[model samples]
Target chain A: MATLELQGIRKSFGTTHVLHGIDLAVAEGEMIVIVGASGCGKSTLLRIVAGLETATEGRVIIAGADVTRLEPKDRDIAMVFQNYALYPHMSVFDNMAYGLKIRGLPKAEIRARVQQTADLLGIGQLLERKPRQLSGGQRQRVAMGRAIVREPKLFLFDEPLSNLDAKLRVQMRAEIKRLQRRLGVTSLFVTHDQVEAMTLGDRLVVMHEGRAEQVATPMEIWRAPANTYVAGFIGAPAMNFLAAELVEGGAAAKLKAGATIAFADGVHPGGEGAPLIVGIRPEHIQAGSGPGSLPLKVDLVEPLGAESLIHGALPSGETLTVRMSDCSPLAGSVLPVVLPPASLHVFDAEGRRIEAVRRRERTAAAGAVGA
Target chain B: MMHGPIDATRLAAAERAAMKAEAARRRTDIVTHAILILGVVLFALPIWIVLMGSTHDVGTIARGEVPLLPGPYAVQNYLTALGEGSARTTRVPVALMMVNSFIMALLITVGKIAISLTSAYAVVFFSFPGRMVAFWSIFITLMLPVEVRIFPTFKVVSDLGMINTYGGLIIPLIASATATLLFRQFFLTIPDELVEAAKIDGAGPLRFFKDVVLPLSVTNIAALFVILFVYGWNQYLWPLLVTTSGDVETIVIGIVRMIGSEADTDWNLVMATAVLALLPPVAVVILMQRWFVKGLVETEK
Candidate 1:
C-alpha cells in the first residue's frame, strides 16, 4: 500500500479550464471517491493522477515519489475505465497477464498471479473466454482482475460501475469495496453517483464546478456540509433550503415560511437579521404537533415502499419537503410538521455553512473528523 | 361466425388456402433455383471451355472444332506447356511464371497490409503536426487510381534502376489507399478508453500495436490479403510497362504472350497458363471467405 498526494493540480484545454486547482493527500490503503455531476472535472483529476493527462501546474506524488512527468506506463498505477476497456481480442487470462508481461514478470509468476486474482474476483472459470463472450458484470470483474494482478502502487477507477445495470451496479459496488479492503491498496475513484460515493469511499471529495466543495467522510459530509452545494449534492431528493434570517441573538432563525426554528447545538456567529439559508434534510423533518410544529399544506405524497416523501408548502407559501416513515396523508390537507433544532444546517448569504460556536464544550465535536 | 355443427366447410377452405400458399411458395422456389442455375452455368461455361480447350491440339482449336470432352493428350500437353518437355521452346516456364506471380502477390498483400495498418494507426492515434494533412494526403490518393498515375510511377521506377526487378513489380502497388481507408475506418470505431487502458498497462505504442491492434485486425488483414493478392496477381499493364526482361514475368503476362499476333498462336499453351493462373486467387478467396464476411459484417466484438 502507498500514499498519494496531488498538489494544486490544474487542467485546461486551450482557453477552457476543466480543473481549476485540486489538492488532496490520500493515506495508505485509503479509498477516496471524487463525486460530482457531469463535466465536473472529477474524471479529469483521476486521469491526471493516472498520468493519462498532464496536470498543467501540479505535482502527482505516489509513494512519496513524483510521477507528474512520467508516462502512464511508468507511473505504476492501474486504472479501471468506465467501459471496462478490456482488450476485445484477448482472453480473460491474457488480459490480466498483459501488464505483468509488459513489466517482465516471470511467466510462472504471472500465471499464478492471474489465477489468484481471477479466483479472487470470482471469474476463475472465465479465463479462456474473450471479453465479448462475457456478460457486462463478468467483464467488469476481468477489468478489476487486470488491475489487481499488476499490484501497482495505486488504483484508479473512473466510474467503473456506471455501465452495469442498477442491480449489478449495487452488487459490484460492494464487491469493489470488499476487494479494496482485502487488498488494502490506496485507490482514487471518480463517480457522478452520490450513492456510490457515500457507500464506497473512506472520504468523499464532493466537487462542484471544477472545485472541491467539501472533502470529508460520507457521514460527516451528510451531517455537516461545508456549503449549500455539498449539502444538496450528498443527499437524495436533496436537502431542502429555506430562506431565513438570524433572529433571537443568533440562537434562532426566522424563516420566510413564518416559522422560527432555534439552534439546539449552539448559537451561530452572526449579527441580527443577517440573511441565512436554513437547510434541513427531508428525512430529518418530522410530521408532528409539538410546540415548535408548523402547518404544512400537503401537495403530494410520494410513497417509496417503506417510507414516503411529503411535499408541501408552509403557511407563508414557502415550499418544504418532509420525508417520514409510514407517512400517509391525514384526513386534513394541512399536516403539522417540525424542523428539528439539531438537524438544521445554517448557511450564510454566500451559501457557506456556518458552524455554530459552543462556548462550554471543550471537546469541539463540531470540528470535521476524518474517519 | 360458426353457424353450423363444426364449421368444417370454412376449415376446409382455410386448409385449401394454406395448400394454395404452399403451392405458390414452391413455384417461387422453382423460379429462384432456375435463376441460380442460369447464373452458375453463365459463369462456369467459359471456364469449362477453357479447361477442355487446353487439352486439345492447336490445329483442332484453330479450325474451331474445339472438343468439349476430355482428350487423351492432357498429360502430354500439360508437360509441354509446363516446360518439362522442352527447355528451349519457352523463355519462361509456366512453373517459374507461377512462382513469380505468387511472390509478387504475397509481397504486395503483406506489404500493403503492414503499411496500411501502421499508417492508419498513426493517423488515428497520434497527434503530431500536420497529422490531418498527412491523412488527407493519403486519402486523396484514392482519387488517383493506378492507371491515372502509371506514367509518373513508371518514370520514378525507371529512374531508380528498378525497371526489371521484383521491387519494381510489388513496391509501387503496395501502398494502397483503399486498404488504408478500410483500416482507418476500422480503427476509428475502437474506443479511446482501450488506448488509455493499454497505456496504463505499461504498453508502449509498438507493444500495444503488436499485442492489441494486430490481433484485433486479423479478420481485416485476412479480408485485405485476398483483395490485394488478386490485385497483384492480375497486373498486366503495369508489369508490361515496367519489365523489358523475361525473368520478372508474371503469370498474367506469360499467358498473354503465349498467343502470337500472327497465325502461330499457341491457344492450348495459352489456355493452360490461364487455367494455372486462376488457381492461386481461387485458393486465397476460399481460404479467407469466413474472415472476409465477418470483417465486412460484424465490426465490433
Candidate 2:
C-alpha cells in the first residue's frame, strides 16, 4: 500500500481546457471514486495518475516519488480498463501472468501467483479459457485478477462494471469492495454513475465542468455539500432548489414558493434581503395536512414498494419532489408539505453554501419543533 | 362461424399455391445447379486435357492428335520430365526448375509479408514526422505495378548487380502495397485499448509486436500466404527479364522453353511440367483455405 498525491494537475487540449488545477492526496489503502457525467475529465485525471496521459502542469507523487514523467510500466500501477481490455488471444492464466513474465519473474512464481489470484477471484476453473470464450462477468473477474496479480502500489478502475447487467453490477460492486478491503490497495475508480460512487467509494469526488465540486467522504458530501451543484448531484431525484432571499436579519430564508425556513443551527453570515438559493432533499420534506403548510399541486406519483415520490408544482410554478415512506398522494390534487428547518440548506446567489456560525436557542427550538 | 367454410377453402387454395411455388423453386434450383456444373466442367477441361495428354508419347502428341484418353506412357513421360532434361529445348532439368520456382515463391511470399507487416505496424502505430507521407508514398505505388514500371525496375535491379540472383528475383517484387494496405486496414480495426493495455503491461513496442500483434495476425498471414504464393509461382515476365542463366530459371520459364519450334518440342514433358507447377499452389490453398476464409470474414475476436 502507498499514498498517492496529485499536485495541481491541469490538463488542456489545444484551446479546450479539460481540468482546471485538480489537487488531491490519497492516504494508503483509500478508494477514491472520481464521478461525474460524461466529458467531465474524471477519466483524464485517472489517466494522468496512471501515467497514460501527461498533465499539462503538475506532478504525480506516489509513495513520495515524483513519477510524472515516467512511463506506465515504470510507475508500478495496474489499470482495469472500461472494456476490460483483456487479450483476446490469451487464456485467463496467460492474461494474468503476462505482466509478471514481462518483469522476468520465475516461471514457477508466475504460475503460483496466477493460480492464487485465480482462486481468490473464484475463476480457478477458467484459467485455460480464452477471453472471448468467457462470459462478461467471468471476463471482468479475469481483468480484475490480472490487475490484482501484479500487486502494484495502486489500482486504477475505469468503470469496470459498466458493461455488466444491473444485477451483476451490484454483485461485482460488492465483490470489488470486499477485494479492495482484503488487499488494502490504494485505488482510484472513475465512473459516471453517482450511485456507484456513493456505494463503492470510501470518498467521493463529485466533478462538474472539469472541476471537482466537492471531495469528501460519501456521507459528509451527502450531508453537507459545499455547493448547490454537489447537493443536487449526490441524492437520487435531486435536491430541490427554491428561489429565496435572506430575511429575518439573515437568520432565515423566505422562499418564493411560499415557505420561510430558518437556519436551524444559527444565523448565517449575510445581510438581510440578499438573494439566495434554498436547498432541501426530497426525503426530508414531511407531508402535512394543516392549512398554514406549503401547498403542493401534485402532478405525478411514483411508487417504489417502500416509498412513494410526489412530484408537484408550487404556487410560484417551481416544481418540488417529496419522498414519503407510507403515503401515496393522488395526482392532480393539492397536498400540504412542510420543509423541516433542520433539513434546509441555504446557498448564496452564487450557489455557494452558507454555513451556520453560532448556535441560537430560538433556532434550536425551531429545529426541534420541525423534527 | 359463418366464415369457417370460406376460411377452409381459402386455406386450401393457399396451400395449393404454396406447393406450386415450391415446385417452381425446385425447378429453378435444378437449372441453377446444372449451369454451375457446366461452368465447372468448362473450367476444368483444359487442366484435364493437360493431365491426360501428359501420358502420351511425343510422336502421338506432336502429330496433332492430342488424345483425350489415357496412353500407356504416363510414368515414362513424367519420369523424363522429372528426372532428365528435355533434349530439344533449354535442357535444364524440370526438377531443378521446379525447386528453383519453389524457393523463389517461398522467399517472395515470406519477404513480402514480413516487410509489409513491419511497415504497416509502423504506419499505424507510430507518429514519426512524415508518417503519412511515407504511408501515401507506399500507397501511391499500388497504381504502379511490376509490369507498369518493368524497365525502371530492371535498371535498378541490374544497376545493383543483382541480375540472375535470388535477390533480384525476390527483392524486386517484395514491396507489396496490397498486403501493406490490407494489414494497415486491419491494424486500424484493433481497438486502442489493446495497445494501451500492452503498454501498461510493460511491453515495449517490439515486444508488443511479437507477443500481441504477431499472434493476433496468424489468420491474416495464412490468408496472405496463399495469394502471394500463387503470385510468386506464376511470375513470368520479371523472372524472364532478370535471369538469363539456367541456374535461376523457374518452372514457368522452363515450360515455355519446352515449347520451342513446335516441330522439335516435347509436348508431353511440357504438359507434365505444367501439371507439376500447378501442384504447389493448389496444395498451399487447400492446406490454408480454412484460415483464408476466416481472415476475410468473421473471427472470434
Candidate 3:
C-alpha cells in the first residue's frame, strides 16, 4: 500500500482541453471516489494516475517517487475498466494470472496467487470459463480478481459497475468495498453516481468541469458542503433552490405560485431586500402539516415502495417535492404543506451558503467577545 | 351462400380453376429447379474441365476433346510430362518445382504476416512523432499497383545482383500494403483496456502484443496466411521477369515454361507439367480453406 499524489494535472487532446488543473492525494489504504458528470475528466484523472494517459502538465508522485513520465508497466498500479476489460480469449484463471506472468513470476506462484484470488472472490468454479461465457456479475468479479492478483500498490477503477444491472450493481458495489478493505490497497474509483461515491469512498472528491469542488468525508460533504454546487449535488432528489429576499433578521421567501413564507435567524442578515436562493432537501418538506404550513397544490405522487414522493407547486409558482411514507387521500390533491424553519437553507446571490457561514462567524465573534 | 352450395354447376367451375392454379405452381417450381441446376453446372463446369484436361494428353485437349469424360491414357501423359531427362534447357522438375513453390509461398506468407503484425501494432499502439503520416504512407501504397512499379523493382533487384535468386522472387513482394492495413484495423478493434491491463502486469510492448493481440487474432492471421500464400504461389509476371532460369523459378513460372518454343512444341508434356504445377496451390487452398474463411470474416469485423 502506497500513497498517491497528483499535482496540477492537466491534459489536452489536440486542441480540446479535457482535464483542467486537478490536484488530489490518496493516502495508503484509503478509498477515494471521484464523482462528476460524464466528460468531467474524472476518468481521465484516474488514467493519469494509473499512468495510462500522460498529462500535458503535472507531476504524479507515488510512494515518494516521481512517476509522471513512467509507463504504466513501471507504475506498479492496476486498473479495472468500466467494461471489465477481461481478455476475451482467456479463461478466468488465465485472465487473472496474465499480469503475474507478464511480471515473470514463476508458474507455480502465479497459479497459487490466481487460485487464492479466485477463491477469495468465490469464482474458483469459473476459472476455466472465458469472459463471454460469464454473466455480467461473473465478468466483473474476474476483472477485480485480475487486479487484486497483482497485489499492486494502488488500484484504479473506472466506473466498474456502470455495466451491470441495478440489482447486480448494488451487490457488486458492496463486494468491491469489502474487497478493498480486505486488500487494504490505496484505490481511486471514478463514477458519475453520487450514491456510490457516498457509500464506497472514505473521502468524496466531487468534481465539476475538471475541477475538484470539494474533498471531504461523505458526512461532512452532506452536512456542510463548501458551496451550493456540492450542497445540491451530494444529496438525492437534489437540494431544491428557491428565490428569496432578506428581511427583519431572517429571509422572506416565496414559492413559484406566489405563496410567501418567513424564516427566523438562520440566514445571514445581508443588505435589505437583496434576493437570495433558498436550498431545501425533499425530506425536509413534510406532508400533512405540523406548524408554519404553507398551502400547496399536490400535482403527483410517486410511491417507491418504501417511501412516497409528492410533487407539488407552492402558491408562489415554485415547484417543490415532499417525501413522506403516508399514501394519504390528499395525494394528487391540492393541499397545504409546511416547511420547518430549521430545515430551510438560504443561499446568497452567488449560490453560497449564507446562514451556515453566519452561524460560524457568530460563534467565532462570540468566542472572541467572551475572551 | 346457401344457394351457391346447392349449385353443382358453380362447384364444377371452381374445381376446374383450382386444378388450373395447381398446374401453374407446379410449372413454376419446375422452371425454378431447372434454372438452379443449370446455374450449378455453369459454375462447376470450368473446374471439372480443367481437372480432366490436366490428366489427358495435350493432343486430345488441343483436338477439343470433351473434358468431363476422361479418355484412355491419362497415366501415360502424366508420367511423361513429370519425367526427367527432358530436352528443354529450362525444364523444371515437378518435384523441384513443388518444393520451390512451397518454400517461397511459406516464406512470403510468414514474412508478410510478421511485418504486418509488427507495423500494425506500432502504428496503432505506440505513439511517436509523425505516426499518422507514416500510417497513411503505408496505407497509400495499396492504391498504387505493383505493376506500375515493375520497372523500378526490376532495376532495384538487378542492381542488388539478386537476379535468378529466391531473394529476387520474395524480396519485392514481402511487405504487403493490404496485410499491414488489415492487421492495423484488427489491432484497433482491440480495446485499449487490454493493453492497459497488460501494462499493469508489467508487460512491455513485445510481451503484450504476443500474449494479448496475437493470440486473439489467430483467425485473421490464418486467413491472411492462406491468402498471401496463394499470392506468392501463383506469382507469374514478377517471377517471370526476375528469375530467368528454372533453378529458382516458382510454380506459375514453371507451368509457363512447359509451353515450349513453337518449333519444338510438346503439347502432351506441357499439359502434364501444367497439371502438376496447379496441384500445390489447389492443395493449399483445399487444406486451408477453413482458416481462410475464418480470417476473412474476422477481418471484416
Candidate 4:
C-alpha cells in the first residue's frame, strides 16, 4: 500500500472547466469515498487519479512518484468501472489475467494469481464462464477481481455498485468493503449515494460544484458538520433549518422567539440581533409539552417500520421535520414540541456556524473546515 | 314464415359451388409448383448450355450444331484448350488465365475487407485531431465512383510502376468507403460500457481492439466479406485499365477475350466462360449464407 496525493489539480475541456484546483491526500491503506451530485467533478477527480484523464494543471504523486502525465497503464493503478467491463469474449480467468499477460508475466504465475483472486472472491466456479453468462453481481465481482489480481498501489472505483438492485447493492457494498479491508489497499471510491460514502469510507469527501465541500471521518461529519451543506447532505431526512436571530437579554446568549431557552455565557459572540439560520437534526428534537415547548402544526407522518418522521411547521411558518421512535398522536394535528438547548446549531448570516459559548466543545475542534 | 323458407335445390347448388371453389384452390397449388419447376429449368438452361458448349469443337459451336443435351462428350476440346492432344504446335491453354484471375480476386477481397475494418474502427471509436474531416472525406467517396477518378488513379499507379503487377489490381481496389461506413455504423451500436470496461482492465487500444472489438465484430466481417468479394470479383473498368497483358487479365477479361480476335463472335464459348467464372462467387455465397444473413439481420438489434 502507498499514499497518493493530488495537488492543485484543475481540468478543462476546451472552454468548459470541469475541475477547479483540488488538493487531496489519501493515506496508505485508507479508503476515501467521494460523494457528490452528477457533474460535481467527483468522478472526474477519480479518473484523474487513475490516469484515465489528465489534469490540465497540477501534479499527481502516487507512492511518492509523479504520474500526472503518464498513461493509465504506466500509472500502476487499477480501476473498477461502473459497467464492470468484463471482457465479453474471454472467461473470467482470462479477464483477470489480462493485465499480467500484457506485462509478460509467466503463464503459471498468471494462472495461479488469477485462481487465488477468484477463490478469494468466491468466484472460482465462475472463472471458466464468460461475462455474458454471469449475473450483474457476479460481473461486478469479476471486475473487482481483475483489479485485485494486479495488486496495484492504488485502487479506483467509479460507482461500482450503482447498477445493481437495492438488495444486491447493499450486499455488494458490504462485500466490497470486506474485500477492501482484507486487502488493505489504498482506494478512491466515487458515488452519488451519501449512504454508501458514509458506510464505506474511512474518510468521506463531500463534493459540490467541482470543489470539496467537506472531508472528515464519517461520524465527525455527521455530528459536527463543517457547514450547512455538509449537515444537510450527510444525513437522511436532512437537518431542518429555521430562520432566527441571536438576541441579547442577559449575560447568557438567548435565541429569539420560539421558546425561552438560555445558553451558556458568550454563546454565538458574533453580535446581538444578527440574522441567523438555526439548524436542528430531526432526530434530536423531542416531542412533548415541556419548558421549551413550541406549538407546531403537523402536516405529514411517515412511519418507516422502526421509526417515524413527523413533518410539521413552526409558528413562523417554516417547515420542520421531527424524527421519533413511535408514530406521534399529533401526526395530523397541531401539537407542541421542544428543541433541547444544546441540540440546536446556529449559523450566522453568511451561512457559517456561529462560534457558540462552548466553542471548544465542537466548532473549535472543527474550525478552519468548510463545506 | 313463407319468406324464411328456402328451396332445397337452391341450397344444394350453393353447397356444390363452395365445394368446387375449395377444389379449385387445391388445384392452383399444383399449378404453382409446376410454374416454379419451369422457372428452375429456365435458370439452369444457360448453365447446361455453357457446360456442353465448353466440350464441343469451336467449328460446331459457331455453326450451332452441338446438341443441347450432352452430345458425345468431347474430351478432345478440353484437351486441345489445355494443350494436350492438339493439332496446333506448343499450345498454351487458358487455365493459367483462370488461375491468375482467382489469385487476384482473393488478394483484392482480403485486402479490401481488412483495410475497411480498421478504418471503420478508427472512425467509430477513437477521438483524434481532424476526426470529422477524415470521416467525411472517406464517406464522400461513397457518392463519388472510382470511374470519376480513374485517369488520375491510373496515372498514380503508373507513376509508382505498379501497372501489370498484382499491386496494381490490389491497391486501387482496396479500402471501400461503403464497407468502411457500414462497419462503422454497426460498431457504433456496441455499448460504450464494453469499451469502458476494457479500458479499466488494463487493455490498451490495440488489446481492446483485438480482444473486445474484433471478437464481437465476427458477423459484420462475414457480411462485409461477401459484399467486398463480389465488388472486387466483378470489377471491370479499373482492372481493364491497369492490367495491360494477358498474364494479368481477370476472369471477366478472359470471358471478354473468348468472343474475340475479329468481328465473328463465338457466343457459345463466351457464355461457357461466363458460366465458368460465376462458380467461385456462387460457391462463396452458398458457403457463408448463414453468416451473411446473420450479419445483415443481427446488426439491426
Candidate 4 similarity to native, TM-score: 0.85
- Candidate 2 chain B minimal-lDDT segment of 10 residues: B291-300
Model 1 Cα shift for residue B206 (angstroms): 1.1
- Error (Å) of candidate 1 at residue B182 is 1.3
lDDT of 3 at A193: 96
Best by DockQ: 2
- Among all windows of 10 consecutive residues in model 3 chain B, the one with the lowest summed lDDT is B83-92
Clashing pairs for model 4 are: A85-B197, A213-A371, A267-A357
DockQ of each: 0.67, 0.70, 0.57, 0.36
True contacts kept of 2: 0.76
**TM-score of candidate 2 restricted to chain B?**
0.91
- Residue A49 shift from truth in candidate 3, angstroms: 1.1
Model 4 misplaced regions, further than 4 Å: A249-266, A290-296, A312-315, A328-332, A359-371, B1-94, B121-128, B159-161, B186-204, B260-268, B289-301
Question: Comparing candidate 3 with candidate 4, which one achieves the higher TM-score?
Answer: 3
Weakest lDDT window of 10 consecutive positions for candidate 2 chain A: A356-365
What's the TM-score of each model vs. the native?
Answer: 0.93, 0.94, 0.90, 0.85
Instruction: State the lDDT of candidate 4 residue by residue for A57-91, as single tens digits.
Output: 99999999999888888888898989886666678
